[model samples]
Target chain A: MISAKLKERLIFIGPLIVLPGLIVAWPVLEVLWLSFRNRVQIFHIDRWVGAANYLYLFGEDLRFASAVSNTLYFTFVSVGLEFLLGLGFALYLRFSPEREWVKGMMLIPWVIPSVVSARLWQWMLHAEAGIVNYLLQSVGLTDAPIPWLSSPDLALHAAIFADVWKTTPLMVLLLYAGLLGIPENLLRAARVDRTPPFRMLFCILIPQLRPAIATAVVLRLLDAFRVFDVIYVMTGGGPANSTETLSLYAYRTYFQSLQFGYGSSVVVVQVMILAGLTAVAYRLLQGKNPAAAGDGPGEFHPRRTEVKE
Target chain B: MVPVKRKPIFRVETMARILIRSLAVLAILAGCARSGPLPDENKTVHYYQFSLPRDREAFDRLRTWFHEEHPEVNLQIHTLPTSSDDQHQFYLTHLGSRSLSRIDVFALDVIWLAEFARAGFLMPLDDLFPEREWEEFFPAPVQAATYDRHRYAAPLFVDAGVLYSRKDLLLKHGFAHPPKTWEELVKASRVILEREEDPSLNGFVWQGKQYEGLVCNLIEFLPSRNPFLTVAESPRLEVDRVRRALGFMRDLVVRFGVSPPSVFSMSEEESRQVFQNGRAVFMRNWPYAWRLAQQEGSPVKDRVWLSPLPAFAGDASGGKGALGGFLLGIHPESPAREEARAWVRFLASPRAQRVLWQDLGLTPARRTVFPDLPSRGIPLDVLRQVMESAVPRPASPLYIPISQSVQAYGSGALAGVYPIDRAIRHIESDMGRIMRVMH
Candidate 1:
């Protein structure tokens, strides 16, 4: 027989569960359905073409391939740099006795909105009148000013640098929390054992902070893979489409080109790639620990027994 | 075991209390954001428009006048994005839906007439705009507003591509006249650049970005040779003429080095900035730049010279400006057709045309409205010549995709990424595919 508590919980939770289902899942499901159907004329007519859109993305369009590679390149470079920088900052803050004030100041870049940050970076990197060029020229770096936004080779790197600047603070905050959660006794034990500083980081500290590193990297990877605003504001995916990320490509196809059939396919491919990466991340983080199997707020296990000062 | 002081209940109570208080405050703030709803009205005309930089003051004046005079009709104005690409996409999102949008009147770009009309987003204005009334606007703008034998819109204003030059700079370099052809333009620019040792100064500047501005630049160049080939006849593209014209454009910057590589990052305003500061000897831009160049504090003030965009040396059409203008149309799904039609009629009137000319410096689409104004300035004379000899872009329903293809390939050529010949071939083939789909 069902307990009275169980029946009461079901009655309370049923409507609450449906709220998220309606808000998020329903639209995602609708777009998924649209991916299967071919939009013959605007959104009025639809013809069923199962997996045809997916096949076209892989087989037919060179733009889709280029966009995929560009997105991956952006993701890999951006997340990798952010990780190293964030870890470095977090480690410094942890070891330094008088870094509380500096820690607050460092979060300012992350606090500023993304669009505002992007526009600021765009002005700073302006080829003719920007201060960056002015400084470079004053120091006798080169005789000619660099075309930061106009050149195909330089546009991607300029945009990547901007993304790295905007996101590294987030990584620092997350990794700092993980750094604090480490037990003091363990560090003392390592000190007693005379373990080298690098070994302590790679073997003990990093292994224990696996969950936070996983969260930070996966979040940044997902965000970077579909980058739009920084690239849009700075390069506009131009100079021979050098900085066109997957999100910008999908947006251009759906809105500018008015090709719903193909645009939805781009979105579907992005989702598939993100899901695969996330699953791999989850598996890697779970490493011999079944209790810490899930991601996100409620599902994630509290691995810390004590918060070190 | 030690008895623990577990304060979970008290902590939960405090959090719940704070959450409830914040929710109430947020609810009050949300209410403060919105005023009372409008009263029930029979006619509510929602005018949707892209926000042109120069037209804001005129738009506000017109909106106020229309509302104050006609109390029975609720005339509201909505501003779309300034960028044409974004504005086009915004309209498509609303108009492409299965249901009717709330927008009653649409102030359209000239290139959008074919697309919106073919898609049935626009109501034919043949009934609303009679022949006598339609003939008031210039023929080129009228022609641009027409599609499938139906007048889809009434012309609002005129914009034609023109070349702006510094008269003092040219005279200093010993040139008595403006360049009449591509070859002459290059020769004139080179001489000026050689004499002026300023690294900031350039021979010429124009928009070369991968956008609609880039398409405008390419269009001004391409048709001067054949004068007959257009994307309207894309399947039968003249590859050789296109190659020559594009080669001329690319050679201006890449080969000749008259323009900076940064031109690829510029639009109309950026190029204007380069020329208005006396850094550029000449700039290819629209008539709006004339007003800005003639501003009091401008470095090139009173030294400005305007001319028609130069053609090839042997071309029949001398300095043919590409046709560009605005059109106002009615939405077929509008519930307030009467009010919307009245708004359109008011805009096309003599009073409206005068303000558009005098206040905003937008070249009036009406022939009789600003006939005497051309005699007032040299720029006005050049403007008149360009308007008279203008050629419209291909009135295709697939203009968005067609223009995208041109921007991609054209920008490739200008950026030195793709060779001019290869770029021409790609544009022709891509445009051929678009034409087949259109047919």
Candidate 2:
């Protein structure tokens, strides 16, 4: 004999839970499992070699170190630039009274596909026949056309600049949302006090958006850390492996070299690094939220719903 | 009360039986799915290939010709990306999974034949293609598709690297013909470049990117300096010879300023676009470009001329090229192997080769198809000479990584990222590590 309640639960909710497990959980678990085995090729049954793949990459490969450094450098710089530019633009939007159209207009680059933006940037930055070079030479800023993509020193910067262009718009919208959430009463009080504009900006606006800033920074950092398409399209990680990231490294190691075990180890390392960084970001900003009244200590509690009676 | 109790029990019994039957049916379906799809009765054979204009047209004609010959068998041609590396990577993952029904025949790059065979992706075709049929095509191409005395692929069309020059430009500069030697080429290009004085124009253009093309370009430079350098087992390149050759290429850009700095970023198509746009005096490309260069509305349509890549100044027998071609291999795990074999046999026939040549301008693998090459085309004499003199890239199963290392360091040296000496040492070390780990 079956209980009606248990049967109904199994018939309906069981599928809803099991379907996601089959699709998402299975692949995630497979990757974790594959990271331990020494599967050099795709089909061959490989022996379990616990942490050898990880040890080989971290210990033996110099390229791995360079890749990690490059990834971190690229991520930090790209995110930092996006944050500064995005906040500045968002502030500009806030200061202006009628700029509803500006938000939509600025999203052109963000809306265009990453690959398209990369190709467009590449063409515009070409050594010859590029409008950028033409302008540089015409203005007497440079005697000759710059080899933007060809120069090992300049290629990474070019890629970063292109990335900043493509992603800054998204950051602007996020910060704008944060800026809009600032209570009108708070600003009115600052105005009533005749607070200096710069002082109000530094003390009020900056302190108020700490939660948004942290969230934005962490999200942007994670996105920037795994950037593969822009650099791939722009420079292909070359001139001399100047712009290869961990993701690109793992991809090549996995697909091109057929060393799946090593590649998975690289991916696992990357995931751990991102997680550690995210934790650090959360901890540093954990106590800065003045709006929360002992609700929690280590949570990113936005003050959106907080009220003063 | 007793009758009511019996009825309820019977109802429960019926429900239990129904559930048991449903579970058994579901189990049967799951097992069938696990074992993979049953072989189809209509016998559709899938041919995996890459798309180029000539290849597309050639296959279209062959598809019709093929159906006329074998009415009972069905064919499905699937196109992959044109990049050889991409196609190989696709198969590496696809065939590695051992898909049962998707692909039957694979038109693979000649270089990939060894890797595929070694990895057990391809079936041994010794019985399918007999000795007499194997003896029909050129020996070098056949040798390329064989590993461990087992023939794995049937040679399709062939390609070889050639030097394409602006004949009109060379003639205008008082050179009656194309340069016969690398030294002569440099001297002539310098004279013409100085006279032309166009900032956009470069004297020479070639594929200098960090990829397979670099190996092709570099191999042509090697034999002139060290004639014994071959892509055979235990291959060795003389250090000084490599330096001289790479230095010569670097000098064209860094020393003489005849080739552009942009050449470092250019691939085959980019260089071709430059040459065909009348911005470059010379180009190095394959036979496919010869056909493309002559297409309508091309800037250098009537002015382009072809020849073997130049040798060292005095070595008469030193001009060599990279032997390039495509071949078809049957998937070992394919269910429709017999139908696929029949398709391969038809394609290997000389009649198909003739149709391919006539329609698409593809160079045939068999020597017999050449005598009847259509007259209204770019002269085949130069292509024949180049093909005869062409050499193959290293015939190793680990060729992908080997070529990647070469491309990376070779382009680095060419782009002045490292001096030639340091670049060679780096290449040697990296290649050694890669080979040691992989093999």
Quote the TM-score that chain A achieves in each candidate: 0.86, 0.86
Report DockQ per prediction, comma-separated. Answer: 0.32, 0.20
> lDDT tens string, model 1, B110-187?
999888888888998887766787777778898888888888988888888898878898888888878888788888
Tens-place lDDT per residue, model 1, A61-129, is 545666788889999899999999999999887766667677888899999988999999888998877
Error of 1 at A227 (Å): 0.9
In candidate 1, the residue pairs with backbone N, CA or C atoms under 3 Å apart (3 or more residues apart, or in different chains) clash, namely none
Q: Lowest-lDDT window of 10 residues in candidate 1 chain A? A: A290-299
* Candidate 2 per-residue C-alpha lDDT over A1-309 given as tens digits, one digit per residue, 9 for 90 to 100: 779999998999999989999998888778888888767574354668787666766765655776798889899889999999999999988777556568778899999999999999999998876789999999999987898987777888899999999999989988888887777667778888999999998888877787788788888988998999998888777766667788887887777867677678888889889889888877776557756744244433344432332
Q: What are the lDDT scores of the predictions, listed in order?
A: 0.78, 0.79
The DockQ-derived docking category for candidate 1 is acceptable
lDDT of 2 by residue, B1-439 (tens): 0111324546878899999999999999998887957446448898888886767766878889888988877788898998776887888878877644477898888878777887888898888766777776776677777887788888887887899999998999899888788888889889999999887788999877766787788878773634323445544445677677788888888888888887877778888888988999989888888877888999999898899889887786768787788888998777778899999888878998777677766678877667777745678788777776677666667666666656766777888867878778765654554444443
RMSD of each: 5.4, 10.1
